[model samples]
Target: MLGELEMVKAVLSGSRRTVVLTGAGISVESGVPTFRGRDGSWKNYRPEDLARPDAFEARPELVWEFYNWRRESLRESEPNAAHLALAEMERKKNNFLLITQNVDGLHCRAGSRKIMEMHGSLWQIKCTKCTHAREDFSPLPPMPECPVCGHLLRPGVVWFGEPLIPGVLRVAIDEINKSDVFLAVETSSLAQPAASFYQLAKDHGAVTVEINREPTPISGFMDFALHGKASDILPELMAGLSE
Candidate 1:
């Protein structure tokens, strides 16, 4: 196992330009459960079933209810140490790009400036019927109908059957392709395109590194795997980089 101290040293002394891909594991430190875990409160429901356009079409209210709960929960949580560490790294490292599968805005909350929210964000709501969208600071439930179109507003997240936002994905891919180092932070390799992003980074000749508690399907595929909580590991690494 690479010690956190060494990881930071490696990052600071590494080749130019670092690209990061973060996922649910990173947010788990912030008290957000993996929504699909067997013991999870939201376990019975498929995110696909609740997050899809079809679901919104059939039962917009239910979709709103589900997301409302998520929004409320998110409102109560704060960014954790790993989030702050990444944000701090962004400040020190001029060449950094952050791509996250997490819909929570914790990365931004932690002060990371250059971020590509791959799955979209909970802070934004958009109408399915129209191009209408807005950023709301209120913790109001997701039910507020679009004043313009009177259509129900939904969270601006990518559902199971939806393609990633082209602009965001293109930018993330461009950074990944140009990166000298790729960090896959606290992610399960089981997820779809999120999992495939590591492969894309590898194909571009970036050294791929993973930080996770357990071995994932991509464990062997990485140039290195560091087993530990990202909160503990990343801060330690960031401290080393500042030395």
Candidate 2:
């Protein structure tokens, strides 16, 4: 049997269209907190509590505090090797798409142009009472307000029990259905929609690959399961592509 690297490389070499799905694991190496593991708690509250609509509704200031802390933590973090490798892959591939669940903008900072942020970005702010949303990286006040309308502004993230921005999910599925190769990189494969994306790609005749530090629920189903840090594995895979 071919080794994992060889198998993935072979599949990628022959594919015309490729899609990559990523999650929080991809950004861990860059010092961003996973917010699901050991670092998941803040002020005795679990991430689930602060990440829900009810929590924000009950205490908008508290929710903003959590998010503000997260933003400050990620402010100085830089994209790691895995992020750079994927960006390089995008530059080389004629047809490539990146679908990510991470709210952080590391992938964009790494130079990836064709991207779908399934989870809204932390940098984006939306007015609660109007259709006003814009990307801003500047420091925000304790409680931000919309400039367009004097309404409260909230982070443009898809909180728990919230639906994704319209058309994002549809477009992602459409791309996955037509891809020739699909890679799940640094994702836990536990979240809905994204958890099933690899299966969808496989059903549609795409070669499926998983790159993660640990075996996820869908690892056994992939055509090739590469286990390691994406920062390490992706650069090696990129090297194979160049050869």
Candidate 3:
């Protein structure tokens, strides 16, 4: 098998246009619970039900309760070393982009400058009427009202049935299309559209790499597969580039 350092060197020497895609798995190291895990449940509701538009419309209070609890859980969380390593790596690269499926705001906290959040952020809220959005860390009431238009405020997130923000998807696609080095870091490669990026990048003649604790759907197609935690693997990858 090729050594991890060899993989890192190969990635770095491969291209200047690099794109890194991150998912919930990466945040696991920072103590964030996966949405499907045991603690992800609130009351009798499944996580999927709570994140749907119909649920929020029916019982905004209950949905807000889950969100408020999540905020509390996320309040003290810090970015793991993997997130930091990605930020630092981007700094040294000429053209790089970080596309993430997380709403925890950890990538922003880690100082990543060029990022396309595929999902909206938990720290933000959007008005159901107008197109107003802003960071809101305030306590969630049973039904929060949009400060600008007095309309119902929804969590600024791409819920289960919602489409990704068009602009954000465009950027992610463009970055992936142009990248010569594409890293799927801690993602399951199962989220649709985003999941297809590994293939898209490969089709565009990019070197596709997968770094995950276990094999994902596209593992067999990746040019390089590193089975491990990104928290440990990413730093080693960076060190290999420097060596």
- Leading candidate by lDDT: 2
Instruction: Write one digit per residue (lDDT tens) for candidate 2, span 72-120.
Output: 8889999999999999989878889999999999999999999999989
Worst 10-residue stretch by lDDT in candidate 1?
Answer: 4-13
After superposition, candidate 1 runs with Cα above 4 Å error: 2-8
lDDT over C-alpha atoms for residue 15 of model 1: 58
Per lDDT, what order, best first? 2, 3, 1
Query: What's the lDDT of the predicted structure labeled candidate 1?
Result: 0.83
lDDT of 3 at 128: 80
**How far off is residue 148 in model 1, in Å?**
1.9
Q: Give all candidates' CA lDDT scores.
A: 0.83, 0.91, 0.86
Candidate 2 minimal-lDDT segment of 10 residues: 1-10
- The reply for model 2, stretches above 4 Å from the true place, is 240-243
- The predictions' CA RMSDs to the true structure, in order, are 1.9, 1.5, 1.7
lDDT for each residue of candidate 3 in 6-110, tens digit (9 for 90 to 100): 866666765679999998999997889886667766777788999999998898888888888888889889999999999988887878899999999999999
